[model samples]
Target: MLYSEKVMEHFTNPRNVGEIPDADGVGEVGNAKCGDIMKMYLKIDNGIVTDCKFKTFGCGAAIATSSAATEMIKGQPIETVMKLTNKAVIDSLDGLPAQKLHCSVLAEQAVKAALSDYYTKNGIDPAPILGEIGECAHCAQ
Candidate 1:
């Protein structure tokens, strides 16, 4: 499938591609059917996302989405980051193939998962905010 110039750029040179040893929050999600996995790291300070990073084991689309997701959330307030969606990530990359769209979903979920972890660590009930962090049903389809 053909990818956008932005997608190719990120696939070749993914940003925030590493782990934060002292991350305030960490989240991991995977699609066993496709063998794609994503791990996200976040550092929050005073309700703002100070930093973000990720490690993705999957296709170019997955890597690109992860890169875009981190860049979008970094330096933003937690409230803003929480509103992030797969559509936003996909749009940021110009777009993704219909089949590869699942990657974008994974990216969104990963970020929310990290935020949930952050809230939980801080003694807050993430369930009330993040809802349910579930696997990508589209990936399984």
Candidate 2:
């Protein structure tokens, strides 16, 4: 199969599939690889990610990765959430096909992008904290 079992599961039953209109931070990233898009929303309270949601217009891999990513970061502290890596998301999903690896990168980037937005919107520079969001072949320019 092109996708792992976990990938199918998440794609079939994605978590946090909507949005939080009042989200403290929000990020929308487009995938250059397949021209897909993923938008993440985060609600932070007391430095904690009290809630998170995602909307992905992509393949099964993208939707699965986004679902797993939101599940991984929700309710976690910003510091912890910022440390999330694509490797972790890929690992959590068991494993993905080589071509689908870019999907995980989108998950991580979207989360950090949202966090960085949160920091920037709060008048605090995100560079010192979250560092650079990194350029991704999957992310748009």
Candidate 3:
């Protein structure tokens, strides 16, 4: 499979590739069984996603997707970041091959997960669009 030069570039030298200690919200997504694990850290303030960062262990596509997703969300409103979709992340990369599309989904999910953490921590209900699942240790349980 021929990966795009851009994908390789981001994968080789990903930006915001680390954790945010004492982060306002942290989203851990995908398990070892899934062959990809991504964790996103966010610093939100007054409804704005002030900073975004991620650590990913997966294929080049996964790394690039995580990198791009973090870059996309930084400085954007938390609500806007929550609205970002896997399709948008994939499109931002020009497009990922069919098999690699799931990586983008993981990235998108991670962002939502992070935002959910933020809302839960602050005792603010997440937007209805987030689908308000039953609370777990991460959410409102």
Candidate 4:
């Protein structure tokens, strides 16, 4: 499959890779069928995303999406990051193969999952906002 220049760039040199020692929130998601797993870390301070990082074990698409997603939210406000969608991630990467689109979905979900963790840790209800953080159903089918 062909990947965009942006995708290849990210795959070759991912950004914000690794864990934050004192992350305010963390999230992990995987697609059992695809054997792709992603973990995201966030450091929020004063309602802004001071930092973001991720670790992904999957194909090049997964790694690229994770890298782009982290770069998208690093210095944004939490509310702004909450609005991040897979489409945005895909657009940032120029695009992904149709079959690999699920990777972008995972990126979006991972961010929400981390936000959910942050809310929960702060004694806020994540269910009403984040709904359920579950495995990627796209590849399961």
Local distance difference test values of all predictions, in order = 0.94, 0.91, 0.84, 0.92
Q: State each candidate's clash count.
A: 0, 0, 0, 0
Clashes by residue pair, model 4: none
Question: What TM-score do all the candidates reach, one by one?
Answer: 0.96, 0.94, 0.89, 0.94
Judge candidate 4 at residue 136 and give its lDDT. 67
Better of 2 and 4 by TM-score: 4
The C-alpha RMSD of each candidate to the native structure, in angstroms, is 1.1, 1.7, 4.8, 1.3
Candidate 4: misplaced stretches above 4 Å? 132-134
What local lDDT does model 3 show for residue 31?
Answer: 74
lDDT of 1 by residue, 78-125 (tens): 999999999999999999998898899999999999999999999999
Model 3 misplacement above 4 A: 127-129, 132-141
Give the winner by lDDT: 3 or 4: 4
A best-first ranking of the candidates according to their TM-score comes to: 1, 4, 2, 3
Best by TM-score: 1
lDDT of 2 by residue, 33-130 (tens): 66678899999999999999999999899899999999999999998999999999999999999988888898898999999899999999999998
lDDT per residue for candidate 4 within 1-141, as digits (tens), equals: 899999999999999999998999998888545768889999999999999999999999999999999999999998899889999999999989999988999999999999999999999998987777665667657
**How does model 4 score by TM-score?**
0.94
| Model 2 TM-score (2 dp) | 0.94
